[model samples]
Target: MRGSRITRLFRTRPMTHETPYEADTSRRRPTVLKALVFIVLMGLVIAGLLAAATLLRSEEGPKIAIAEPEPLAVSVIPVEYLTELDIDELFTGIAEARRTSRLGFQTGGRIERIDVRVGDRVKAGQTIARLDTRGLGAQLASSQAVVEEARSAHQLALDTADRQRQLQAQGHISQQRVDEVVSQAATAMARVDAAKAQADTIRVQIDLASITAPYDGMIVSRFADEGAIAGPGQAILELVEGGALEARIGVSARVVSELVPGDIYTLEAETGPVDAPLRSVTGVVDPSQRTVAAIFDIPETTGVPAGSIVRLKMERKLEEKGFWVPLKALASANRGMWTVYAVVGEGEDESWRAQPRLVEMVYPAGERAFVRGPLEAGDRIIVDGLQRVTPGARVVPREVQRAEAASGG
Candidate 1:
């Protein structure tokens, strides 16, 4: 019991160096445990960052796809009803004088002197040329001498008849002698009158030997010169009536009926346009051309000579119902037919479809056409960008303003 008590007393005594070292180890153990725990938490945070980076590298988010192409944008125009159409037609014609004539003398003779040359203007009743009058002068002088001699013989016979009548009453001469003297006087008087008539006939021939102008005119050509022998009815000069210009145009019956006589119309001359009066129209149709001759009196100031080519323009109106659309809007279809695409629905969100309408071309004027089809007024038709447009194809409607050209030229 005493040994045990001594040992217990020794254990209860103050600590030594080894004992201090054990207490120090126990204090540092908590710090080492805290450091280990900090290292583990940092490793867990790094692991979480690595996992997030791997998820970002993978292409697992929402994807993007190319959008469908937008509908073809096109230009369009509104079509309307065409009540009537006017077609312009140009007719060819020639400018000429109102009266063209070949002038000659009434009698055959040698031309003495040509008073006028070609392109000479003359007045009515003016002498243009003369023939030799030497032969006529001699014959006229002989006729005068015969008339004088016949008159002297008639006076002598008359004196003899008076004396014989007085002698018969006095019974100195017979009545037969008086009758014979009276017969002689009558025959002489007849000869005198016949001679005078012959003289007058020669004088008239002298007047007819010369060429005179029948009216105011110009000589366009000369067929006979001075000292040229010309026969009657042979052309000596080509005379055109002066200051009277005209045009002879051949026109169709349809056009001829529409033109009224005395109405003014326009003509394209060599210089420029001129207004003239319509004179007449021959209803007789030419077999070759199937046209009638229409006479228009042209103004003299136009300076158009004969045989000059001229032009006449006219507008013909036809009664028809149709629509005018751009040529670009037309598309060829089966069996030689044409079609146009018309937009039916009219809204941004609405589905507008290209509907083809069978169209018959009434007339084509330049880049536009007048057509008749199964369509209504205010129908929208695609004009440009036609390559992308097709029948029954969905399209985006973009309208364009344009003027309707319906005139057929």
Candidate 2:
């Protein structure tokens, strides 16, 4: 029993080394748990860092695209209707005298006296110039002397012929002698007739040596001086008749077709406005100018000097066919051509876009142009703000009133 008790006590008693071993085991377990917790926390932190880096890289790359921009807003007008208009066509013309003449001497001679200078008024039968007639007068006097001598000889011949006939009747002279006297008398008579004719011719020439005005006129130019020698039929002076004035103008064939013989028109002269009546229209066209001559008779009281340039205003209704558009709608292009932006798209879902249409401006009346182009009726054309849009660019068109478009507002 004693041995059993001793062994049980020794076995139940706590050893010093045993207690320290239990404490060491307990400390080791706590350290292992702390290391495991640190490892798990580090793993979690590294995983979170990797996820954040991946997210930042994805954000730095290019993004997905968005929708396109909206279209621009613009005002548009439809193609206008054709109308007949009385358009005034202006032409430049020169004022002229109704009667113009270039006067010259009939015979060649040295000039002696010029009575009238340039711009001198002259009347009918007034002597304007004269040639030296000293030699002509001497010749005329000599011719008259010869005529007088011939007349005396003719009287003697007549007396002799009568005496010869009487002698033949009295039988005192032979028949042959009477015949000889008659022949002599006939020769003398013939000489007298020739002398008289020559004297008359010289007298007529002396009258022609003085240059006289054939009608009332004003001298415009002088070609021969007082001492200059002039040939026969050479121009000596240029004269223009007063009291009636005329205007000569060159116009197109189309204008000539609209004119009449007595149609009245207005002329803007340097002095003032005057009424000019159409006198004549030439049937032939001038080849160089491709125009026809139109003559108009104006009153002399207008005081418009000859060769004064004046403007002729004429208005006529024409059957023209074209569309009128605002000047802002036109875009300058190459070779004097013009472009207009038109809205081409249709329906609500379709987006309206700019489309270029070529046009030619025929006539410009006021702020609008009469244009002809490849455009259909009712086609919408952008008028306001063409610079803000381009061809093929989407545009929102706002319709404009026809009256507003016509008024160019």
Candidate 3:
């Protein structure tokens, strides 16, 4: 019985024992299979995430943004509703004398002396100069001697004729001899009369040697000096008569109709402006230039030199009230046709936009222009930066007052 119990205990102990290699093999096979399954699942998840990222990127739309507009700098003049101001049409012209004369000697002679110089004032019939009178004096002396000699011969013939007449009446001498003496006496008296007339002519010729001024005027020039030979029709000096000056201006045919004689005008000189009256308008028109000559008489004023340049301003008949803008505001698409850009308000927040407006320009006044348009008073217009502006474009209104203050207006 002891031996059988020992065998059963040994078998039961042996039944709990196993090989190490077999245990390891079984555990490693399951672990490797679980690892492969985990790798496959992780790979599928990563691929799905990459595909979703690519699709999201391709389906996205473009990003858009808007920027604020830049502010504009501008200047503006106030518009007011006032009475129509009569603006004169200013014309550029030169000043001249109303009556200018080139004084010269009527008779040729050597200049003995000059009594007047430039800027010298003289009166009418004033002796301005004298010439050499040596030849003239000699001729007058010879004429006077002939007159004396003829007078003596006439007296002797008169006495002889009277005695002969008395003798013939008393029959003391032959009639033919008395008649001969009477005819001689008559011829001698005729010779005396001719000699006296010739002497008188010579006397008058000597008086013209002195050159005198024809009217009251100021001497503007002196062409001949002392001892200079002066010929006939040679200008010796220049004279401005009547103390009146004039300006000769060329007026176009379109404006010539408004100019007439006795119209008043203003002339701008270096000193200041002066009032002048229109003297005359030339009837003959210059065919080549299509202009007429306008003459304005300037009043006598001190220091207003003749031949100086001046500008003439004349009033026109047609007048109206309109906006006067600078010439740069006008744009030309064709000859005589002009347009400008005007700003019209669209809404309170949207501001105004540029709108092309047509105008008819009548004439130019200095740097400003006078135009006729459908726009009324207080219309805002762009005077500068017109090329960048277009119709229906959004713009930021830059206050003109603020810009002017910044620029030290």
Candidate 4:
């Protein structure tokens, strides 16, 4: 009966706020809310204790400090600023003697002797070779005999004419007889002159058969040999004048305009480099080659031989506003523009970063280039280890001295 009564008390029906069941429910609701609040407060206290334990554990060990990355060490060189660059142009040429001659005998005859070989050096007036004058000796002797006989007859005629004139004066000879003796003497003297002229003609023929070098030269070729028959005007030997050399080069009009005659210039030869003076410039351009001829006279003691391949080195001003930079410092970029890694900083500060500058390569000069655009003087640029660098990267640049850079450091 008591348990039934308790069940009835726990089981309540809907009623007005003034009923006992309503009062009990209200009181229980307040107690349950308080218990729920206490449970949440206990959970908060436990979480706070756990957090404090974590803080104590974290503080028990040594602290670690984060470190920044080290800067890359690189070699750098300053941009060599310049407004002009010399464009070296080499024109191919041939070294030749100042004078070349093809020597020959004036008259046709058999070559009796050849005193000079194909490479013999001879001086002026040196007899190179001579035609065999032995065959003409008999003819010369005959001429001489005729001249001597004529001279003897001419002396006899004079004596006879003198005797006749004396006889005519002494009245021992007629005037017509004296006149005939004078005429005979005059005829004998004419015979002597004719004989002397014949002998002189033979001597001239002998002189014409011989050959002599007209200048100091070397025999470059021999077209005729001993015992070979050569005609008049046929080349017997080819001679090139020594002690003077010249280069004949063809150059464009633009290049020729930059050259001045009588200026000293250097030339490349098989032997070595030689200094030559500009002798002349053919101002007219060739119709076929469209190039003008430039003549340079080499020094006598240069040891450059004739017929050697040669070259003329000419530098023309490009008149460009650019600076010189090593090729290693240049990194190719987009749209044909090139980038260079330059280190910029306060002059005395060691903290420098790599800054990329856009440039145009105007000319390529061996290991260097002429560049312009977005670059300034005194800007140090990274040269070594280009493949390992990037823009705005921290770098420790070791500046390469000007002398070291020039020596290919």
Candidate 5:
């Protein structure tokens, strides 16, 4: 009965908020909340410790600093003192004869025979063509007949004059009669002299009927054919003197200005190169090409032909001051200029580096170039290791030996 009464009291107390069951529930809820708070605090402390440990470990490790690369090794070519620069300019030209002539007959006539054809070589005074002299022959014969008749009459008059003079001296004739007879003889002699002059003129015309070459040359063109009537001074053939030849080349004003007569040059022909001397340079420029005409006399025409294409080569020495550098040292720049890397600084100094400088190319001779730029007189330019360097990069400059430099190594 006491147990039952106790159970009933417990059940009835659970219905009230201030009962022992409610107090126990409230205290259990607070204890459970406090335990959760302690677990969260412990977890927070562990996380903080792990983070601190990681930081300490990273600090304790060795610190590695990245090192800079070594300077690039390069060979340098010293800037040379150059007083003059040589420039080569090649010009194309056609070979021509030193002397050319268009041969023709001195008088008009019908062409009868052509002795030579085009491309036939003829010697000096060789007849290249001839005209039919049938008409000239008839005229010459008539002139000769007239001259013979005049001479016969003159001879008779002379005899008569001599006889008359003698008779006058002997008093067989008066002075007036002698004078008249002498005057008649003089008139007859004058007629003979006129006839002789006419005959001589006809002979000269006959000789001129044959067209002849003026010199040893080859016939370049034939303007007249057989049976063609040619007028006086009409061209019948063109001749080119083959012995002495020349090449006429057109060059710019600058190049022509450096050329002078009597200077030796070179002519690159199909056979080989031949020496040619400068003959003439025109003072006036050509209106169409804006270039000056230059004539060079070839030494020999053994392997050269007239009207053949050839190259005229000239090495002009320029007065501009510059320096010669290996072709490998040059770097292309804008406006047709170039760049070069120069090692500038004292020995073993940290400031020693490659500096790029602009340069103007004056001429190129084989593997070297004459250049003018902002470089000093004795600047050391980097020739090797150009591809491995950049502007302002440190470089170890090793001077190239004289022999190697000269050999363009």
Candidate 6:
């Protein structure tokens, strides 16, 4: 009875299924939660410290500083004023005589003698060449004999007419016979006149055999030699008249209108410059060249020879109070608008400032340019460093002097 009671008691003991380990884990659950919370708070604190350190490092980075530019060094020139400026038109031409002639023979014959050679100077009416007078002399002699016979016959006719008149007046002969004698005398007089006229024609032919210079000139060429046959209209010699020389040049229509007679021009020869004048202007336009012929009378110069190649600079008009500067000084900002920079003054700190000024081009005077602008006498211009300069840009001005004086400026 004691063993059964012990077994029943053990089986029916209420079945309480709880261990010591389980009770210990259930008791530490709140502590584990507290530990995880502490770990999360520590991580947030560490992240905040790292972000603050990064911000401090960024604030200490490198800094940038912009540098100032240096002042540019440049050269300048001053504008000038003039009383008269020449609008020169330059053209190339050849020197020619005022008059030229080609001497030829009127009568065809063999050349007998040559009196002048190439480069030989002669006066007007000077015999340059002579044709063979073999036939011409004989013809002249025959004509002369005929003239003399005609002269004698004319005197005889006059005497006969007077005699016949006297006989008719005295009635010594019949009226019919007197009339016949008078008619014969009149016919004889007419024949004498005809013969004299023929003789004069022959004399002219004889004179034509000798080729003579029509004016004072120098023989440039001899076309016929001794014993050469010269025909009528055949050129025997070429002559250029000596006195004043002239240059025949072509000018554009625009230039021609500006030119006037008696205007002075300068001709550049091999020796030097020769002063000349505008002699005449041709109204006819050359269809091929589109230009007019302008004749300039050049004074005779011993140093300059005829047929020389020369450069002619003609002054079409004069521009009073004009300024000139170098070609490099010209600058263009907008289309068809030009300007130039002028050096105004040096600052207290030794820096130069340039002022941009607009200009109008009058004309080109040789290598320089004649201009009209808001520039006064003795104004400095920036010639060398124009591109690097602005209106108010600081510059270091350096004076540039020209080698020669500007012409027509």
Candidate with the greatest TM-score versus the true structure: 2
Q: By descending lDDT, how would the candidates be arranged?
A: 4, 2, 5, 1, 6, 3
Tell me the TM-score of model 2: 0.63
lDDT of 4 at 276: 88
Per-residue lDDT of candidate 5, residues 1-409 (tens digit): 9999999999886665487787789779988999999999999999999998888789676777998677777898778777876677788888888898888988888999998988899999887788999888899999999999998998888888899899999999998888888888899899999998998998888889897777898888999799999999999998888786888888888776678799887779876787888889987898998888888887664568777888877677788889999999998899999999998774664446899999999888789888999888888899976788798787776543355568896
Cα lDDT computed for each candidate against the true fold: 0.84, 0.86, 0.76, 0.86, 0.85, 0.80
Q: How would you order the candidates by TM-score, starting with the best?
A: 2, 3, 1, 5, 4, 6
- TM-scores, each model vs. reference: 0.57, 0.63, 0.60, 0.55, 0.55, 0.54
- TM-score of candidate 5 versus the correct structure, residues matched by position: 0.55
Candidate 4 per-residue C-alpha lDDT over 1-409 given as tens digits, one digit per residue, 9 for 90 to 100: 9999878876775445487887788789988999999999999999999998888788675687998567787887776677777798778989888889999988888899989998899999999988878767778889999999998998998899899999999999999998888898898899999999999989988988888999999999998899998898899999999998889899989887788998888888998989889999989998998889999998889998788988987778898898888898888899998998888763564567888889999988889888997767777888888888877777876543345467895
**What is residue 129's positional error in candidate 3, in angstroms?**
1.0
The alpha-carbon deviation from the true structure for residue 25 of candidate 1, after best TM-score superposition, in angstroms, is 99
lDDT of 2 by residue, 145-245 (tens): 98888888888888998998998999999999988888888888888899989988988888888889988889999998998998998899999987778
Q: After best superposition, candidate 2 residue 270: deviation in angstroms?
A: 3.4
**Which residue pairs does candidate 1 place in steric collision?**
none
Error of 1 at 388 (Å): 25
Tens-digit lDDT track of model 1 for 205-252: 899888889888899999988888888888988888988688989988
Give candidate 6's error at residue 83 in angstroms. 24
What are the per-residue Cα lDDT tens digits for candidate 6 across 1-409? 9999999999887565788799899999999999999999999999999998887689676668897566677877667787676576777778888888888988798898999889999998888788887786687688778778877877787787788788888988778877777777787778778877877787787788888888998999888799998888998899999988888888788777777889887778877898788899997889998888888887875457888977866566675566888888888757555799987766575456788888877777657787777888888788886767778887765432132223322
Candidate 4 RMSD computed on C-alpha atoms after optimal superposition onto the true structure: 22.9
Query: What does the lDDT read for residue 255 in candidate 2?
Result: 76
Error of 6 at 107 (Å): 1.2
Which candidate model has the greater TM-score, 1 or 6?
1
lDDT of 1 at 18: 73
C-alpha lDDT (0 to 100) for residue 3 of candidate 6? 100
